[model samples]
Target: MMPQQDQPANPAPLGLMAFGMTTVLLSLINLNIVDATLEKSFVLTMALFFGGIVQLIAGGIAFKRGDTFAATAFSAYGSFWESLAFYWVLNSEPIGLAPAASARATASFMIMWGIFTFLMWILTFKHSWNLVWIFGTLWMTFFLLAAHALRGTEILLRAAGYFGLVCGILAIWASFCILFFEHTGVELPGASRPL
Candidate 1:
């Protein structure tokens, strides 16, 4: 008799997958904004640069492991601005221009991601509506707030800080869900440390 072959288990629900990917993507995105907005501080610069790279790498690894949704989410945002950062560094003459351009870019990126998240949430409804959807929608609001804050609006800045903190907390919670509930044999690429 032929030996039986083991099939890969079905992946997590779309909502859960989207939740994990979005959380990771948004966290890194927020850090990028903070890096551009904050004054010239070495510690912050090194932290953001290295941290963002780590997150991007993790996202790539996750994608390789079959988390296509998250992999794309993390890698797309990671590469998008990281490439921009490199360009900005290479063309260093326009000092003031870089920050402004970064802000605008971040804003545009956030808006697009927000829309993407919404669409993902809608698709997730086909699976089941749950806390994941509720929190996901609320979480996307932070992106809108961050986009406004990057535009130099004081109120939006405050809102962004508040919302960003909330998003971070929610992300940690989602990570725990993936860590505890999902039984994928492979370890999550970025679970070892903060990204």
Candidate 2:
């Protein structure tokens, strides 16, 4: 009989941290807690490198580990960050000079992401509470941003920022839980239990 190949290390935690950190930074800007200039100077760089490239690498590792859910989540969000960074970079001065997306177009973009996240959230029910909550707030954040764009309402944007912050924090906690389990074989709360 042929020997089985060793399994790859879990990649979800790395991807989760990447996503969480970038989301938190962006959420801070959305909340007006951080200087708006940082979005272009700092956040976009993080989105392109850490959230985008690193998460893409994690997605590839997850695919190797035969984790379809992690693979899809990491890949999709990685692309999202990359595309968002590119949107700003291409539109800003001394770059490609591409016209900025209109509010309608931005709303449409966010709505599409919201729909995608909602579908993914439905799938998270079979996973764990951490994932369920992470995806749940994530979809809400996307929808709230879409609503803000569509209605030009500051309240909706603020609401989205709050939801996004929660989602990012949850994701970071979940990442630590996974890392803790992998290191010490102890499952953190809500990490191994499904609803």
Candidate 3:
């Protein structure tokens, strides 16, 4: 066997930070505390550019680092953000603006994401409980949002937003933990530094 070479750096923090910040901003809008039209446009831009493109790059790096989980999670969710942008933008059509997606369609879309998150959360147990909680809450948030969309109720959506906020905050904290772990050499409360 060839001698193993030094591995590349971890790519999780960049992807996690990108996803975390985007989620926080979007969750604020979902909470119904902001102007929907403006915030949505801005959020879509960030989703396409930062969340989509940047996370894709980070996932590529993770693949180079030989991390299957990071590669899969970051790349898949990056594509998800790009798909969200496509829905809001190109969905209008070449001739005339199409009608908004039906509630059922939207709910189904969210439910699919919930399913993906559930699968990813199962993988996160190997990383740390902090990562697990982030994915766990995020999984629930998607399902809650989907249920609210299906029911046409603000209550459930708002609840999902709150859960999303928690997920976002936890993700950011995890990113920080990974970034600073080398220096501190001690795990933060409810956080971990996965290799």
Evaluate candidate 2 by giving its C-alpha RMSD to the native, one decimal. Answer: 2.9
Task: Tell me the tens digit of each residue's lDDT in model 3 across 34-147.
Answer: 678745578888899888998999899989888889999889989988888777775644523556788899899999999999999988887887889999999999999899
Q: Per-residue lDDT tens digits of candidate 1, residues 12-116? A: 223233333443444345446445343233323433353245457656665656766556655654554466456445445555444445676667766766676
Could you tell which candidate, 1 or 2, scores higher by TM-score? 2
Q: Tell me the spans in candidate 2 whose CA falls farther than 4 Å from its real position.
A: 1-5
User: Which candidate number has the best lDDT?
Assistant: 2
Clashes of each: 0, 0, 0
The TM-score ranking, best first, is 2, 3, 1
Pick by TM-score: which candidate is best? Answer: 2
* Model 1 CA lDDT for position 69: 58
lDDT of each residue in 33-98, candidate 2, tens digit only: 999999888998999999999999999998988889999999999999999999989998879678
Every model's Cα RMSD, please?
8.6, 2.9, 3.8
